[model samples]
Target: MALLDFLRQKEFAEISALKNKLALLEKDIEIFREREDRLNHDILSLRNERDKLLKYKDVSDVDNEKERIIKELKDAKEELQKEELESKDNIEKLKKEAEELLEEIENKKKQVVELDNTILLQDYGMYSPVYDFADSEMYKDRLDAIRTEQKNMILYKTAATCSTNWTLNGSEAQGRVMTNQNIKQILRCFNDECDMLISKVKFNNATAFIEKIRKSYDALNKMNSKNAVSISYEYLELKVQELQLAYEYAQKKQEEKEEQRRIREQMREEARLQKEIEEARKDIEKEQKHYMNALLKLDKQLGECDEVEKEVLLEKKSEIERHLSDLDIAIKDIDYREANKRAGYVYIISNIGSFGENVYKIGMTRRLDPMERVDELGDASVPFKFDVHAMIFSDDAPTLETALHHAFENKKVNMINGRREFFNVTLEEIEEVVKANYDKTVEFVQIPQAEQYRESQKILKSLEIS
Candidate 1:
């Protein structure tokens, strides 16, 4: 029984220890459950907070809320990406527009520059004549008539001078007097400006002067706006006409003087040619008589002489006959020249020192000796003697010259004046034109001698070396 009590006590001790371990485990499980409950509450509170932050409406549908939030975020991201692409496109478009605008501005700047440099009117020097008067005297008469009419208009208080009638001290007479004085002063100012511009007007600056006068009219009217005093448009037109007529009149006078000088030169040249032809005829006649007398003497000597002397006399007779034939031909040529006024030598010549290479003066002269005319041409007027390219005898020299001039009309050195017969053309070109127009085969001196010019150049070179 003692042994059974010991075993039972041991058993009771083991059961009591096991019961304590169970109580400790129960307390730990209770603490764990409380922790799990607190954790679950925290998770719920966090989920609620997350829903509020995400603006999720259904708290009970947590998974649906999460899915909806995720989908919304993806949609927002896609929208942001699309907007980013659009923004990039817009930036490129704006860049292109800005570049185009800058190019247009540059083009406008270039246009302004070009306009500033360009001439407003292309017909600068070739001004059209305003008056069709026969002479400068007629132009002067017209100008006098215009001036007299203008003066009469002003004196009679016509439309030439205008003004508004204003009351001065309530007297009509006083108002009239003031208006007259104002009109006079305005007329004087405008006339002075117009006269100044007209005086300065020329072929090149006519356009500028016209603009200035119109501007002056506008400015004077603006300045006298209160008085309403201004020059009439009819008077303005008359003034413009006067300016043009005056310039053209002066030009006409100059042209008339040149024409008169040319006429005098032509008369002198004609007189000289007559004298030369008469002298040449007389010389030929005298030479023919001398040759005839020599032939008669040789014929007498041939009748009396022996074989050797007879042969010499016959030879001398033949030479004398030949001489007489040449003299007769020269007399006939002189007679023809004197009879035919249009018969002359058309010469092509060049002065390389005066003009340049390929420049030729094609002219006609009725001189008995055409070389004399060429020599006269190469006289003191030119720096060097002219080299003759061709000297052609034409029945109607003027017509042939006119034909050549018409052929090379655009190749003239002085295009404005048809009288200046110098042409800038190649020898081949001139030959071609001459062959085409003239029936006769012409020989052209393709190479110029230019002897004096070449010598002068050599001298200059030597001087420079020294």
Candidate 2:
């Protein structure tokens, strides 16, 4: 009887300790969950920043600095792998430790149940042992832990999942956010001082617990929350490289756009100045035409006038002098007006594929954003505004424009090559045309897998080497 009573007291203490540890574990799970949420948000933001940056840079240009980028990528990869291995290994260790503790707790619970059945018996008899069993709340605690165990396990699995996803994205910001959640769980799991983790531990624990309850009992019966953790880690690692590369490209593109904008402003100023010069030239031509007309009139009057006295002739000379003075003033006025009235300036993309310069683009489009459309088609980058400027050269502008169009027709518009002729332009002309007409660069989408395979087969057939 004494032995049974002593065992009950001892069991009570064990149960209390388990409860405390369980609380801590629950807290730890919550920390991880919060961290996971933070990581997800960070990952998405970084992805956006990365995507926006990509719209401006060329893959070919960035490839020149591949060596430097590769090194950075290598370092990031190693760090991520190290963290994943450590966190995962520790989780497994804790799980093993928990299993051993669970066995001990279960043994104690069985003893308490046996003691409960005897509490109704006589004093100093089986009845007294029954009272002891009922008194110790170990049985209640064991049931609670059992119910909660599944939940706790689930929470840990969830934390692992969230943590791994952030890690895989390879963004420092994302990883940091997750780490904040992880710190609390780490403390609970191994106990640490991550501020974010500390705050989230409880919330994570409850969430994980509830999720477990929602799962199928049969599925839960097969114990492997660690498997879920392991899977999450593997998936994250696979995606990290891709995400980082996307970010790098995006950053490069934004810088390119700023440069393009600066060039555009410069072009606008040049066009304005050219417009002024053209207007002045036109005014000079007009004045020259009027002066010639006045000179012809003076000659006609001199030839027709009859011979008269010297005084009369001198007066006529004075009259002609006055008219000459008036004409000079008219010319001056015309020059002044010409100086202020500016002509419209035109810029055209040029030097496309000519041998000694003076080459220009040749393409036709009804839309104003002809060059912009080329960019969407992923054709070529328009280098300068002058390069892409529109012009109407003749009374038959559309017919003469065929020279330009014939220069740039791709002959292939869609991904597949159908017998349908796309255009009648040379390759060189197309490159020039797009450069002269558009500000954005082109980037073609990847061909679908089935099409690629078919293309490969056709190539082999042509070579007779497949």
* Top candidate by lDDT: 1
Candidate 2 lDDT, tens digit per residue, 1-466?
Answer: 3543565588788877876776676566556556545545655654554455454346656654554555554555455456555555655665666676677667556434223324422222111111112322443443344435434544575323432334538687876666555533432432111122222222113222222222212232223333222223222222222222222333334445656775785566445444544564566557656656766665666677776654465566667566667656755754543444322212233322221133433333222223543333223343222234343323232344454444434443421222222443344544455446532253211222233335655988989963
Cα RMSD for predicted model 2: 36.4
**Model 1 residue 76 distance off true place after TM-score fit, in angstroms:** 38
Write model 1 residue lDDT over 1-466, tens digit each, in one string.
2432453466456555545655554555455456545545655655555556566444555576576676665565555456555545655555565455555545433222111113534537656777789999999899888888778778777744445668899998898888888888878888887787677566665655565567667767778878877778877777777788778787788889878887897788789889998787788888888888888888888888999998878888888888888888888887888889899988999988999888999998887778988898888988999999898889999899888888889899996566788999887887887878785477888888999899999999999999
Structural similarity to truth (TM-score) of each candidate: 0.69, 0.22
Runs with alpha carbons beyond 4 Å of true place in candidate 1: 1-126, 169-171, 299-311, 462-466
lDDT of 1: 0.74
Provide the overall lDDT of each model, using Cα atoms, as 2-decimal numbers. 0.74, 0.42
